[model samples]
Target: MTETPQVTGRHRELLDQVLDKWSLHVLDRLCEGPLRFNGLRRAIPVVTQKSLTAALRRLERNGMVERVVVSTRPVAVEYRITPLGKTLQDLIDALLLWTADNLPDVERARARFDDASAVAGGE
Candidate 1:
């Protein structure tokens, strides 16, 4: 096993922020290309409009995403993953692979734990 480096409190906080529920979903979709607000919402149908807006805003503030304004007839906004965000693609891919590989095991573990808990009257 590889040794893990110690992470400072601030580092952990940032990691949690960047990996928030909606942030990863937004990042994953944005990785494909720049997406308009509605496009992102359509792609990630599970996320609410407010949640996606908040995630995009947080990403833009963190320098991981860029917001562009198009001077069109109706005016348009687009969000794209930045180079900083691109730097995390490898890690993201690894996370995706790990989840895919472990999902079955996770479900089995959950079932076993829940069965044990219910037997003990722990709900």
Candidate 2:
């Protein structure tokens, strides 16, 4: 019998860094192509400048994204996914596909949990 490997603290921290709310969105956008800060904001309208800045910094720190200076005159910068980050695209896509495929099952499970909770609350 084979046992599943346990997730360590570093594993959880790395997952949290890449899979956080804004990180995924930023990655998805960068997967399309490089974009300036404002362009990224426009692409992901729900993300505030502050959140986007924080996410970009985190991703850059993790070597998943690269920030480039396109112009010095106006001080323009663009963000692009590094080769390392591009490697995550396939996995992310697979996860999305899995979610789509299993959404009905998930919904049913959620319904069952909610029903049980309601009954317990009534009791």
Task: For candidate 1, write residues 1-123 as lDDT tens digits.
Answer: 999888999888789878999998888888889999999989999999889989988889889999999999899998999999988788878888999999999999999999998999964
Cα lDDT listed for each candidate: 0.90, 0.95
Q: How well does candidate 2 match the true structure, expressed as C-alpha RMSD?
A: 2.2
lDDT of 2 by residue, 19-68 (tens): 99999989988999999999999999999989999999999999999999
Q: Pairs clashing in candidate 2?
A: none
Candidate 1, position 107, lDDT: 100
User: lDDT winner among the candidates?
Assistant: 2
Give one clash count per candidate, in the order shown. 0, 0
Candidate 2 Cα outliers beyond 4 Å, as residue runs: 1-5
